[model samples]
Target: MSTHETSAREEVDAIIAGAGGWRAEALATIRAVIISADPEIVEEIKWRKPSKPEGVATWTCRGNVCMADVLKKAVRLTFPRGARLDDPTGLFNARLDGSTVRAIDVFEGAQVDEGALRRLVLEAVAENRAG
Candidate 1:
């Protein structure tokens, strides 16, 4: 892996570890699912600042696929091109009103539809590659 990619992966690992409890587990699970969806997907740490220096956990193929943030009440997976992707299983539950993005909010004890999420990731990668 490239140096930046390695650093980003390490940053994500730190974020997940720092999250602790169910949030950590959820973020790890989400990361695994996203990676499994496409081997070309790249992990990134974006939007770093003093308030939240760890930044957001972002995944990209040819373009931005999604970003994960550990919220107080939920772990959010926001798809940048979600508006163009089909959601037959209706996995998206937040940011529905956005014109170009959609998000899935995973709260404590909530179950993620892995199959649907994998499909979405694949679709998002394809979308990125197409452009």
Candidate 2:
């Protein structure tokens, strides 16, 4: 990995480590699946603030593929170009009405279909590239 990538990874690691409990576990698991789906994917943290110390985790290729934020009730994974992607598995359960974005909100105790999520990520990447 490049130096910039390493720095970003370290920053994201600190964010994940600090988000203890289920949030931490969920972020780690979701991150692993995203990386597995695209080996060259770039990870970064955005929108940092005192209220939200961890900011949000964003993965991109050419442009944003998806971002995940740990909320009180669920982990929201949003795809900026999701409206254009074909979601056959119906994994997206949030932001359905948006004209450009769509999201999948994973609540606590909910089992994530990693296969479907990965497919969505791949499709999102394709959408990004096509733009």
Candidate 3:
């Protein structure tokens, strides 16, 4: 799929629909992180990801992948294979009790480590290839 083929709203409707208002905001966060890092991947909101590719794309394997969910106070960033990434930044330890796929919660005015999250996503993509 290409940008001329569809619009962002149409793409958002694909996965962000029925996700509620906060869902769009959560999607925005996930997107901001992904683009801020690797701004060159052929990103699209197919199923699991609304602003990026799911499973395999320009990189990675057919793994569980990452996702975000809206919460009462914040959005939870869940990486299904986070344990595989050797994160230099401690952006994923809060929601995770030392697990593979970890969650990073972000809320209003909360200082989110965008670079770190982006690194985590890229790392997950790289890990997919490693295995």
Candidate 4:
């Protein structure tokens, strides 16, 4: 991995570590899936602020693949170009009305379809590359 990507991954790790309870667990699980889906995928932290220093976790390849945001009630994983991808499994449960972005909201105790999630990550990567 490149130096920037390495730094970004480390930042993301810190973000995950800083989270508590279900948020941290969900973020870690999603991070694993994103990384496992593509060896070359880059992880980054974005949208930092004073109140939320950790910001959001962004996974990318040729372009933005997805970003995982830890919310109060759920962990939302959003794809910037989700409208163009085929989500037959219906993993994307939120942001469906948007023109481009789509998201999957994982609440506490929710069981993520690992295989399907991985496939979605792969598909998102392909879409990014094509664009």
Per-residue lDDT tens digits of candidate 3, residues 15-50?
Answer: 445445665556576766664554343343334455
User: How should the candidates be ordered by lDDT, best one leading?
Assistant: 1, 4, 2, 3
Please list the residue runs of candidate 2 whose C-alpha ends up more than 4 Å from where it truly belongs after superposition.
Answer: none
Q: Which of the two, 2 or 4, has more TM-score?
A: 4
Model 1 misplacement above 4 A: none
**Residue by residue across 1-131, what tens digits does model 2's lDDT show?**
88978887898788778767887888888888998898768998788899887677899998889998878888888998889988888989999999999999888888889999899998888777788
Best by lDDT: 1
In the range 1-131, model 4's lDDT, one tens digit per residue, is 78988888888888788777888988898889889999878888888899877778898799889998878899999999988889898899999999999999999999888899999999988887777
Task: Flag clash pairs in model 4.
Answer: none
* lDDT of model number 1: 0.95
Q: Which number leads on TM-score?
A: 1
> Which residues of candidate 4, in runs, are more than 4 Å off?
none
Q: Which stretches of candidate 3 lie over 4 Å from their true place?
A: 2-26, 35-61
Clashes of each: 0, 0, 1, 0
Using TM-score as the measure, name the better of candidate 1 and candidate 2.
1
| Collision pairs in model 3 | 83-100
Instruction: Give the per-residue lDDT digits (tens) of candidate 1, residues 3-92.
Output: 999999999999999999999999999999999998899999999999998999999988899999999999999999999999999999
Question: CA lDDT, every prediction?
Answer: 0.95, 0.86, 0.58, 0.88
